[model samples]
Target: MAARPEIAAVIWDFGGVFTSSPFEAFNRFEASRGLPKDLIRRINAANHHDNAWALFERNEIDTARFDALFLEESTALGHPVRGGEVLPLLSGELRPRMVVALKTCKQHFKVGCITNNVVSMHSPGQDEVQRAAGAMGQVMPLFDAIIESSKAGVRKPDPRIYLMMCELLAVEPGRCVYLDDLGINCKPAAALGMRAIKVVDVDQTLAELADATGLTFGAESVA
Candidate 1:
């Protein structure tokens, strides 16, 4: 029988995994606008590599330009949605269970955060950025390294960024376990030999992490 690979580190995605998924907020925004559900997702996924979302995250485009380009793209898609209207919904409440899981993980393994995020170029955007920073501040100290797309100029699903993270942690990809809400983002990590979990439910993800690392990360751990 082969011995299990020793898990040396755990890498996490910020938005969807740590907080309630922004996708949930996106759906709410679509419904409030009387537009089709998943409209924002479809629009953002249209040109996955260089779309408005990707460009904005990479800081290649400011909020105002993203608003213009996003509206244009949605209009082309038959639903004219304003990017400004959806920006506020980008930040979701932090998940307490995920916080507990993070705490437990840090006790056993090196932890890091890698997020695809945008810069605050305007008012409410600035407010939103501050809010997110505040939420992350509570747990930032737990992370050994933090990488943001806006600052790094590279977003997930890009192999280089994943490699950069492994390099930052000074760990082999095979020795890391990664979690992200987006399956697309998890692909590159898996391809790089990291055990990747696509998070849908917080408990399920925590369970998977515990199994992978042979560490306890249940409700009891939080207590």
Candidate 2:
């Protein structure tokens, strides 16, 4: 292992970072449907690397295929759900404070986003593709670089994705702070020498970012 360097860049995970978590929506969906909690998550976790969700995120499969495949996967677990039904839930409300933190970080350090996102899944009633695009459009430009799994052909928890961001930003993993909502995702970044922050909420994440970057967001500042 190499010696750590002064933080030079900040890498963010999009969904649960800039916006609310889709898991919250998943739980709500499960409750409304009288299904088990974390049911959607359980299906995704079963084959973490090459499951239907993984294939969809990598754009290896289309929405129609994912719909049927996800249903198959879920049914095997006792509860069935079409992948199309889950797409709309992926759209999350953006966090204004987190966006402010990203803008603040940009002034001092290289900022980038690595998101494990699916290609457009135009589910019924809600055009998830359009919703995510419209919201991300305003936020994407704020980053010096952005990598979407749908475009990258690989997603986080894969060390390659973290390395790709470091390459794009011209920084080492040791000199970066990486934030994500999932511990499983954070592990790889941490293993690669980045300071990984598992985001639980807006306040916790912003405070940790300030601590790492010597920056301030909203009323939170680091001394």
Candidate 3:
């Protein structure tokens, strides 16, 4: 078989790829409230392109507006959920194994991150922001480029965001490997000629990264 095309860069999605999924947190919240599973995800998926969650991620709305709007959206879906309640759930615990794989990938290829983050929810001055940075600081500095949707005014599933990362890395799309937790986000990357991996779990993702980059990560406990 012909050898796979050489990969020049590795792009990652921050939240779900590096950390436990916020969807897990959302489900837990839903269970606690006796709401349907995946309700928050459903709400966000509905009218995805122009939803309140999408606007919040692009920084087109402030926290207060997102709160009201998200509540409105959720209420329309059945349960009344405050956006304020959902904001805190977005930060999932970091996965040290994934960080190890990322570090391994960085040694071989240019590394970049494209995250659909919210500006209002992740204000630099917020305590949660400080804590999150402190917790993930070791991994943050390793990236050659980091694009936040809130700052970039574009989110994943939009072709421009993936293209922007390639431009920033000075790499061709066909020569890059991109990993994201959401299939919707992965579609555009794959369409752009990137080798896109939809992350399902740490070990699975690591195994694929290993296959793509031809690198092996240590199994030591860094957690």
Q: Is candidate 2 or candidate 3 better by lDDT?
A: 2
Please write out the lDDT profile of model 2 over residues 11-113, one tens digit for every residue. 9998888888999999999999999999999999998898999999999999899999999999999998999899889888878788877888887888999
Worst 10 residues of 2 by lDDT: 121-130
lDDT of 1 by residue, 87-129 (tens): 7777778787888888777777789999988777223445765
Q: Give lDDT: candidate 3, residue 17.
A: 80
RMSD of each: 2.7, 3.8, 2.5
TM-score of each model, paired residue for residue: 0.92, 0.92, 0.92
Candidate 3's residue-wise lDDT over 22-108, tens digit each? 899899999999999999999999999999999999999998999999999999988999999888788777788888777777767
The local distance difference test score of model 1 is 0.84
Model 3 scores worst on lDDT over the 10 consecutive residues at 120-129
Best by lDDT: 2
Clashes counted in candidate 2 amount to: 0
What local lDDT score does residue 77 receive in model 2, on the 0 to 100 scale? 93
User: What's model 3's lDDT at 91?
Assistant: 74
Candidate 2 overall lDDT versus native? 0.87
- Can you rank all candidates by lDDT, best first? 2, 3, 1
- Which regions of candidate 1 deviate over 4 angstroms? 1-5, 121-130, 221-223
Model 3 lDDT, full chain set: 0.86
